[model samples]
Every structure is written in C-alpha cells, then in structure tokens.
Target: MKSPLAAIPGAAILTLFLALVLALGSGFARAHEGHSHGDEAPAAPVATAPRGASSSSALELVAVARNGALTVFIDRHDTNEPVTDAVVRAEMPDGAATAEAMPDGSYRLDAHWSERPGEHEVLFEVARGGESEIFPVTLTVEAGAAPGPAGGFAAWSAGLAVAHDFRRHIAEADPLPLLIGGSGFVLGIAATLLMRGRGRGPALAVLVTATVLLAGNAALGAETPTPPGAFLAAAPAPSQDLARRMADGSVFVPKPTQRVLTVRTLVTASDMLGRTSELPGRIIADPNGSGVVQSSVGGRLSPPPSGLFPRLGSRVEKGEVLAYVTPPVQAVDMSDMRQRQGELDQQIAIVERRVERFRKLAPGGAVSLVQLDEAQAELKGLTDRRTALDNIRLQPEALTAPVSGVIAEANAVAGQMASPGVQVFQIVDPARLWVEALSFNARVGTRDATARLADGQVLRLRYMGAGLADRSQAVPIQFAVENPPSELRTGQFVTVLATTEASQQGLALPRTSVVRGSNGQSIVYEHTAPEQFQPRQVQVEPLDAARVLVVFGIGPGKRVVTQGAELLNQIR
Candidate 1:
C-alpha cells in the first residue's frame, strides 16, 4: 500500500496552502472593515500594580497603588531606614487625605480613585521634627490583566488564545489572529504526516518556515520602528529594593543602604610606605624610672605604722616606708642577748655604788680626788652599754621606696618571713614607659617607630638601643614611649611598628577593612560608585601596627572602604 501523503500530490498541497492564506487575509480584512486604527490599547498585566517614586535631598518616597489603595514607603534620602512619626498629608483632586502610619514603618492612603486608569498628580507634605519636605509625584495608573504562565510554550499558547479573542473583536490592523490560525494549521498537518510515516526532512522545513513567518508577523504588528537618535537619552536605572550579591561576584549596595550600614570610605594615596617586620614585643618600665624595693636581710614582713601594706598601683615617694621587716631572733641568739643584758645591768649597779663612795671620800679629804673622777667615768660607760643592749631587741629593718612612682607589683604581707634580696614591691614611674620588640633582622639606624595596643591605641616611640645578645634567635630592640598615656602596665604585650630602611609604594588601610572571601582570598571592598561596592582581591602586606599595604589588584586614587566593610560583605 502507498503512503497516505503519497495520495495527495505536491501540487495539491501548494494549492491548499494558498487557499488557506487567502481565506485568512479576507477574514482579517472583513472583521476590521469598519473599525478605526486609533482604538484603545489592550489592558495591562493584571498581576502588576502601578508604582511611583519621588525623591528630594532629605527623603525618598515610593507610592504603590494596589487594590484601590496607595501604600507609601518613606525613607531617608541618605539612609534606607523607614521614616516614622512624620505628619504626612497627600493632596488629592477632591481634598487632602492624611496617610495613616502602618506598623511596618510605611503609610497608607485610601485611594479608590486610583483604580481607574488616569494620569494624576499627588503632592505629599511631610514634616518630621524640624525638617519638612514637599514631594510632588506624577503617577500613571494603567489597566492590568491577569498574569500568564512561566514558560515559553505557555506564553505562546496564551498569545494564541488572546488572538482567538481578537477574532470576534478586531482581527483587522491586527494580523495576530491569522498568524495564530495559519501557524497552528501548518503544524497540525505536518504532525499528521510525520505520524503517518511521511518524510521527516520536509516536515522540519515546513515547521521552520511557518515559525519564522509567525515570529515576523508578531514583531511587525507589535514593535514600531525607531529613529537613530531614539536611544540618545537613556532611562534612569531603577532603585534596588534590597542589597544583593551580583552574578559577577560583586556586592550591590544602594547608597541609602550604605548610609544605614554606616559605611565610610577613604581615598587611596600612593606614597612610600615604610616596610615593617612584625615582631612580638612587650611593655616594660624605663630603667631609670623604675625601682625594686627589696630587703637587705632575712626578716619577717610587717606593715608600716599606717598599718597597711602599699597596694598595687599605689603612688609612693622616695624614702616612703612601705613596710618593715622584723628580724626574727633564734633561741641561741636570744639567750646570748639576755646574758649580755644581765651582765651590763650588774656592772652598772656596782659602778654606781663605787662612784657614790668615791665622791663622799673626796669631800672628807681622806682619799685622792682623781680616784673619784675615775669611778664616775666607769659608771657612765656601764650605763651606755646597758642602753645599747636593750635597743638591739626592738629595732627592725624598714623597707622604703627607692623611687617616687607608682607601685606596679607588691609581694609583702604581714607576718610573712621575707628572705634577703627578695623584691617586696616594684615601683615604676608610669609617665615613662618602654617597649621591647624582637626583630629577626637587626635594625641599627632605625629611628621612627610606633607601638599599637590591641585596642587600636597608638603610642609614639623614640629609638633606644638594640641588644647585642640574641634571644630566641632574634635581636631585641627597645623603644622609649614618648608621652605615654596613663594605665600602661609593665610586661604588657604590644605590637611594635619600626620603620626599616626598605620602603614600598601602596595604599595603606586599616586591618579591619580587609576581609576573607569565600574562596579564602584576601579581599577589600572598593566603593566603586555611590550605590555600588565591589570586592577587590588584593595582595596585602604588613605596613604598620594598625594598617596594611595593598600592593596589587587595586590602583591608587580609588575610594576604598575603611569602615563597615566587613558588615557590607555580610549582606546577601
């Protein structure tokens, strides 16, 4: 048996196609016979509502008309924070309508008039505290249609269905109805031939030509021709509703959002940045300004007459008695002292009686007068020895401050036995502090230096001397802090920034400005535009205690984010 397509000759197929085209054209011409070309436009998408925007130097306002009402979102001109507690009034054609504040920091106006399609002007009067702004907005509300499906095929079907509706409406200046019907008929016939084992190659050509004609007709009926200068002036870019990460791997933050995030930028300058090598250092007391109070002999620790030991950070003057160490006597030493005291007391009593007898004899002229004088001298010597023995038991060693400064360390406690040469208190003049930094390479002629604390506090430094002895395979460099601030403690850790002979040219930025990207690369955010921030991968080197040098990936004279950069990276 022959194929079904073979029954129909090629000439018959050509004649049928021509008849179909003629019939479609005649139907379009007859339907639009009496109609004018100036008919109204088709209704707009039903899912979309009209929205208008107005901005001033102090505020930005967006008004959306939805479900016969207008919702207004008022934000600061600089910051995106929703404005609240502002007396807002909108002037309508009938009268002024005051907007009611909503809980989401927006205002709403009952605008049933917005449902009808028309061009209207609304004047917004906003007053907040001492600031007031007038935003005149022009809004155009258009008739909308229900939203269509989300696929290309679904859109084509929807276009065909709308074309079918136009068959009864116009079908005249609009060729969409004939294009839809002719394309569908050609596709159906081609599909029937393929299912009946016809030629696949010919069927494909037919489908392609029909699809091309369909698209061309749609474009010709819908799109209008434009002049060469039509694109000279471009439309303004729409404001971004939210901060997001762009597909190019850059963060897009609006200017208002940038202000809300408190983002700050610094201009990059190309200069000779001092090459620095980070070294672990610590805060130490100046040698000439610090002193240690220690005991000379082993004795028990005792408080001063003021009855309290000097506390840590206690201010003390030179020769101020911080504490007293009472010498503890052994059993044998106590026995020897008691024996000396008794003998001295007995000798003094005997000499006193002899002196009195001598004086009496001298007055009576029975003995020589020189013997009486000798006896009186012997009594005086015995009495002096007796007094010296009593003093040895009561005297204690006094521990006094050797320098006028604050006590940085205290170890003395009441009744505790303190060994000789043991430091009881450390008195350091806080006005002068020193920093000892260790460097692997010895810096001989280095002078300019700085020390940064962990809390970002910087201190000026003057070059002292570097130690000749190698400690931990590194040389120690000391720096005297110029104009040291209060609350500097000894042995506190600090980062020393010493300028070496080497120099580099780059932009210096705070350490906080750099952040680690998801790819584990060192990235710095550049404020590329007023409302856009782009992450720049950079090769960063240590510049100083608080700043780092960005050598590559970014050029000078660019505005780089110096503050709130990390927060900006967290968006999206």
Candidate 2:
C-alpha cells in the first residue's frame, strides 16, 4: 500500500517548497502602493475645524468658519482680555464684508467662500480707540474628513475598493499574481499533508471552507452600489459651535464662552519662594483677648439687675456684671448660725452689764481702769460677730466678665443650681482670633504663616508660639490672625500654611489653578491657545496661603489658567 506522495521522491517536495517561497516573495514585491509595509511616515494631525490665527503687537485674533459663517475673536495681546468695541472688516477673495458685533463680544460675517473646501486667505481689519491693524490669516479646510466612524454605504464602498484593487493587481501584476501565490501556498500545504499520510480529507475540507468564505466576501463587496472612488471625495458636514473635549484629553472652549466663565491666566515664572507645610488647624480665641465667667462656689444663678442673662453674640465690657450666684444656706448651717447668734447676744449682754458695773465701781475706787477697758473691748467684739453673720445671709456673689468681648457661649439660667468652678459664660473677641495648627514635624519653621478658610478666603497670620508638649504625635502651633474677618467663629476648620526659612525655586500658581483629575492626579489647565486649554499633570507643594509651588511637569513662561480651572476640567 504505497502512497502517491511517497512515490513522488524527496526532490519533488523540495521543488514544491521553493515554488511556495518564490510565490510569497513576488506577491509582496508587487503589493499595492496605497497599502503601507510599515515604512510610511506618521500622518499629520487631522484638522477638526477651519480656523485662522493671527497676532500683532497689540492684538491677537482667531477666525473660525462654520456653516458659511465666520466668527472672529479678538483679544489683547498682552492681557488676553477680550476686545468688544472693535470695528471688524473681513476681506476675502470673493468679496469684502463688515463683521457685525455679537452680544458675546465676537464678530460674525457671512462668508460664502467658507463653504468651499480649500486654503483661502482672509484679511481682518480691526479698529478701536482710533487705531486700526490689518491681520492676514490663512485658513485651511480639510477635504472629506469625517469626525466619527464610517458606516453603511461608506464602509461597504471602502471594502469594495480594496477588493477591486486586489483583483486588478492579480490580473495585471508582473512577477507573480496574488491568486497564483495563494494557489501555490495551498498546494504546498496539501503536499505536506500527503507526506504525513493521515487526516488528508479533513485538512482539505477546512481549506475548502476558508476559500469559500473569502469568495463570498469578495462577491458581497462587488454587489455594493456605492462607487469605489466616492469615499475619498466626501466632505464633512457642519457641526455646532460648542465646547468639547478632544481625543487627546484637551478641552476646546469657544472664545465667547471663555468670557462667561471669567477665565483668567497667569504667566508662570520660576522664582525662589518660601517652603511651606500645610497643617490641620482650627480657629481659636486669643488667650489674652478671651475669658470665661465661672462660679466660685455652689450656688443658685440669678440674672443681673438688668433682669436678663447676656446672650451669645452680646458684647460685654470688662468687669461688667453678667449674672449673680446666691449661695443657699442649708438648714443645719442656718441652725448653727442661730445658735451662734444667741450665744453672741448672751455674751454681749453680760459684757455690757460688767462694763457698767466697772464704770460705777471705778467712781467708788473699787475697780482699776484696766478692768473697765477689758469689759468694753469684749462687748464690742461680740456685737461685731453678730452683725457679720446677718450680712452673710443677705449678700449674693456678682459674676462679672473678665475681658471685653462678645459672649461666644452662655449657660446662665435664672434659678438654676450652679456648681463650684462651673463656667457660666465664654467670651471671645472676634477681631483678635487665633488659629491653632498641629505640626507633625517639631522643627516646622514659623518665619511666616497664613490661614486659609474652607471657602478659599486667606487670612494673614502672625506667629505666636508652639507648644513643647506632644499631642497626638504632633506639636501644637498657634498663630494670631492679623485683621481677622468678622465672620470667623471659634472651632472653624482652616488650613494653616507655615512658611519655613528654606527657599525652593519653582513656578508659583494660585491654589485654584490645580484641580483633581479623573485619575485622582493633580492637573492644571494651560492656555496654549486663544480657546484651547490643555491639561498638564503637575507635582506641586504648599507655598503659601493662596498659592502652590509647581515643582515639575510644567516649566516657566507658560500661561496657565488661574481662574475657572475647575470649570474647565468639567468639560468632557
């Protein structure tokens, strides 16, 4: 049972492999010029919009065309401020037209030439405050560049064109046609299967199935009605003027909307700034300017002569009576006082009788002068003790403010029993507030400091002192607010930035410039163009109350968006 392939000999097998190699090489050498073989240069960035940018010594202008209309945005060259009161004239090859002022500070013109897709030169003349400047802008519109995916007729047409080119190459190419190369490759595979002498039928069947699928796809591509050449000449439809995020993660904001958002930029410059550390802090009352009113002994509380307790936020002066605490006497103490008073009365009566007897006896030479003096002294001492006990039951202790400030806390209630050393009211001076911060590093410098509120309000602070005691693994540092705002309250949270003597060189940007990105990285928006903002991830450190030091990911002399960066990041 000799097989047919075994009889063909080894020379024939080697010849078949040589044919397969030649067929593959020739097929690649004659590949279509449109298809790349991994040696083509990278394509340029696709034009999303037809726009022209021009700048002068005093002004910067951008003109964008959409739907046969041109919108011109003019800004100051130095400050980036929008120019609203400028007379704009547009000169094109077709005709010259005056651009009408829009409510959004942009100029609009009816440009019929913009409908044609090609490069066009437009001259923009801007006049304001008796000065005029002419700027030439070259606008290029890409031909047949669609924004999204192609489907239906366009996709089918693309497939058909590829099939057509393939068929033409197989018919007319010189060295070896792709059809011949594929047939040779199949034959080589069949020969290898025959030499193995097993499962030949199934291998042939699988190859037959792959061939059928290729043929069916080619037939379907030929049946499509769209012509092969129409795909390259298609034009993109007009889109709306809106802010959107580009594919590269940059945001495209129209100039008119930038004004509404109040976008502002700062030109970054590298300089040495004081290094700062952000500490968790809270607002506290100044110790020297604050006080607490407390009862010295257990007693009942009573209102002052004005008849009302000083309420919270009520301003009080130093030594002003806030409340009264009357010490209630127990029954036993009262009984003891009565007993003592009776004893004192009996003693005084006896002493007075003795003193009168001494005076009479002295006149009869029966008593010395020293005896009369001693009896009078004993009578006087007993009367004084009796009077002091009466006054103790009548008088009440008056509670006065220790310092001039507003009553920040109040616990005074008339007839309420108060304990000894209980704080009745707390007073704080709003103008003399202090921020207490906890610094993890014991060596945190206090050369300068500031406090930033939750609402982005910054307060200048003067270094007071730091405690030597460790609390929660951190030292407590105190800073007195200079010219504190009236809205500040005790216990409000604040971020305290304590500046050290060490200096670091970096670009300083406002705290508002940085925003949290989608991936939780800190990013800043750079005003790379008039309306285009690019997000640059940056490494920053605390610089001061209102600014941060950008140490990396951005260089100096770049215009970064200082205001509305958070709003810019919202565009997606």
Candidate 3:
C-alpha cells in the first residue's frame, strides 16, 4: 500500500482534525467548568431546596421546585423591583404550562414532574405590556440523599461504564461521533511522516485513539452538582433573609428584603448647580420679629396680671407685660422714707386740727374767711406730701415684650430679683426665623441658600445681608427662613448651603449616596442590574446642603442608592 502520509491530503486532513479537536476542547471546557470531573470528589449536597435561576439585562428570574409545584419570581434588572401583572408561560418535559399570579407577587406553576430526579431544561416566556423575553435555564435535580462511589475500585468501574455507554452511542453512526473518529484516524495517518523509514502505524493509531478517548472521557465525566459562573454562593440559600456581597463584588438583595428596608433610588441627570459653599451656621431669631424682656434696673421679678409668668413656648404680643420687677429699696433709704413719713404725719395732724378749727370759727364769724381758706390749703399740702411718700415705696417696674412672638426662654419667679439690663425672657417668632452662617470669604451673589437640619429637614432661605466686619476671620451671612416650621428653635446648630456667583455642572446626588469604601476611597453604589448594586469609586464635590456633585468616576442616567446605602454596605 502507498504510504499513508504521502497519500493523505495534508490540507484536508489537518482541517478536519483541527475542527474536531477545537469542537471537542470547547465542549469539554464548558462542561468541566459547569460540572465536575468524575474522578474528583462529589460536591456537597445543597442544604436548601433546589432552585434554578436565570438573568438577562432586563430581568432576573428564579424558580424553586417544591412539593408537587414550582414557584417563579421575576424582578426588574435595574431596580430589583418585583414584576407583577406579567403573563408567564413555561415549557416543561410534559405538556406546556401556565403560571398563576399569587398574592405574594410570585408565579406558581402546578408541575407534576417536580419530584423527578434528573437534568431539566425549562423555557420561560414572559410577556408584559409590549415587551417579551425568553429565558432558557438548565436545572439539575438530585435525590434527597447525595450519591457517592461504593469504593475506590468503583470509581474506575463507573468510568468504564461511562466509556462503554459512549462507545455504544458512537456505533449508532451519529454525525458528531463519526466526525470525531474520522478526525482521529486522519491524524494517525498524518503521524506516519515521523516514522517515514520505520513500521509503526499500529502504535500511532493506538496513540491517536487513546488521546481522543481521553479527552472525550474527561468531558463526559464532568457532571457534579456545582455549576460554573456562580456569582453568588448557593450553599446557604436562605429565603431572602439577608443581602449579601457576591463574588464579583456586587450586592445581591432580594425584592422583598429591599422593601422591608425601605430602599429608595434617585434617577440621575446633569444640571448646573450653582457653586455652593457650606458654612457652619446656627438658628437665630429674626431680629425684627423677636426681642427680649429685660429689667432696666435691678428689681424683684414678679408675674404679670395674668397671675403667672409667660411660660416657655407661650405666645405673647408686642408690648405685653410679661413680668413685674419690684425695685428693692436699701435699708438706709427705707429709714429715710420712714423719717419723712413721720414728719409728714406730724404736719398732717397739725393741719387737720387747724382746718377743723378754721371751719368752725368761720361759721361762728369769730375768724376771717381768708384765714380759714389759708388754713385749709396748708392742711391739703401736708396730706399730699404723706400720700406721695406712700406711693413711691409701692411702685414696681413692669417688664414687657418688645416684639410679638412665642416665649423661647424664661428666667423669672414671683419674687426673683432681676439685675439691671438683664434679659428675663426671650420672645421668638418661630414662623419668622433666620439662619446666620459664617463664610470664610465675603461671598457676593450668595442669594440662594438653604439650611439643612441634622435630622434631614431642609428650610428654604432668602438672602438677607452679609456683615462688613469680619467676625473670627469670617464674614457673617444672614438668611431668612422663607417658611419656617414650628419645630425650629433659636440657637439650633445647622449647615448652610449658599450659592455663590460661580456655577458648576455635574450629577447631583444625595450626600448619603456616597459612602466610604474599605480602602477609604469615596464610593457610590450604582444600580448596575436588577437586584445588583456595584460599588463605584467616585470623586465628589459639595453641591449643596443636601446633595453632592459627582464630578467623576460615574456618569449620568443611572440610579444611585439614596436610602439604605449604609445598610447595603454592611452586606458581606
């Protein structure tokens, strides 16, 4: 016979062998990656119920096979929100089936083959509105108990059985098997070149066949429980009780769990947020609408005629008397007052007697009428002096409200002594409050300002005035609260966001959305897919009191977690 190497067309043979080897190699790689080698130890039995999951750019789907039925769940890929009102159909081994919408937002299919143990390929057709999608998923179901080799010898025995079954299938002349065999045979003939002067065709044939069989066996043996491309661990498949960090560093959170956490998102858009500078500020009473009730001189404090002092938070009007300050007299002054009262009393007694005598004498015509009139005048003057002395000792200073507002503070008792020029009560109109912010630099056009409270409350502000005098190396800028709430109090610390003349353009996000990553880099969780949040490193600038501008690392039109971001970071 002609030398096989010389007779065999090199191009045709090489092409055929290359095609087969490539095909077989890819198949083996995929199978091995997804499954397990027969020689390796079996994977641990899943501790939870059997489940099948599939994902697409638009949706994430999972189906759990349970007692006599199957439960399916579908969520929006970008938001991880459950997709209800969707008609879902499934292709099972038996006839086709339709899933019913359950009250729990899941689809339920009555499957008779739920208990079947083997590999199953399911086709899911989901339709909602004008959009439709198909997902094909392969699920493996094993018996409740995991199987193992009987002994070490049984491992080889099982391998042999697999090989035997493969050989039997090859004998059926399937196109795939025939192609592989032909490729191996052609390659054997091609090997004859190396043995040009020797007779080793039989050995070459055996070697080629062995190599091909070895490769095929490795691919065929990979059928363990675990599959490849598992981004998340499946060992402890709890019922969405927890959010977890996936292997690829994405956050996996179920819809139900996210809802319980009240997770919310914000749509991103770019805009020109005027340049803002944050300043340490405090809540101040509006100067025009608030004032203090104080004593001009040192005196005792006493409640007004309403019988009690104006309580804290008590509403009072302008010029309302809130307290009385009884100016206490010194011991020396009291003694002088007593002496003046005694002298006036002696004079009053003499004038009273003289007036009585004058009236009697005038009636008797024994005294002149002019004399009687003069005596009466003298008695009246003496009485006036005594009355004036009594009145002077009883007068008390009244403290009044200078502005109409609520009482913000009170420091008064019925007999409390109020020192000179001391504030006894503070009246503040809560509806008319102002924020005093300290700016490191004099900022003109800082007309747009907002005050953010520590508890996430925001108050709109109108630019008032900036101080010309630098206070503590900074200028004091005042802003009036446009619509102040009742909860606001004077002297409350706050943060002020003042818009300067400059402007910037970027994505504005809630400050809470940006969090510190493990490496201390600033990171924001991006809604990359449905039920997936990927931490993206970002460069952020202060946009305003409540929002920060994302200048780099992330772009626009993506959802960023505004709420529950801290909770999401704790998932690991």
Model 1 lDDT tens row, 1-572: 65656654677567646655655555555555534456643432222346677887667787776666777877664434467889889997557999999876778999877867688789999989977889887778754311223456445545654554464454454676655676578968776866667776667667557655644544433433222122211221122346777768777664346557767777678888878777778999999999999999899999999999989877999999999988888899999989988998888888888888887888889868889889888888888888877776678999998989998989988899999999999999999889999999876347768888889798888988898899999999999999998977888899887877788888888888898988999999886544567999999998776799889989987778877888987877
Error of 1 at 45 (Å): 18
TM-scores for every candidate against the unseen true structure: 0.58, 0.69, 0.63
Candidate 2 local lDDT, 1-572, one digit each (tens): 87746555577556545555544444344344333334332322323468889988678899988767889999886457889999999889788989999988889999867777689999999999999999999988766543444456556656766765565444245535555666666766776776677555744554555456545534433343333465533524336457888889999997767888888887789998889888999999999999989999889999999999988899999999999999999999999999999998999899999999999999888999999999999899889889998878888899999999999999988899999998999999999999999999877897669889999899999999999899998999999999998999999999999987788889999999999999999999988887789999999998888999999989998889988999999998
Q: RMSD for all candidates, in order, please.
A: 14.3, 9.4, 16.9
Best lDDT among the predictions, by candidate number: 2
Off by over 4 Å in 3: 1-104, 112-242, 335-386
> For model 1, what is the alpha-carbon lDDT of residue 494?
90
Put down candidate 3 lDDT per residue, 152-215, tens digits, no spaces.
Answer: 5445445554554454343333346645675666555647644564445554555456457756
lDDT of 2 at 508: 95
In model 1, which range of ten residues has the least summed lDDT? 228-237
> lDDT (CA) for every model shown?
0.75, 0.81, 0.75
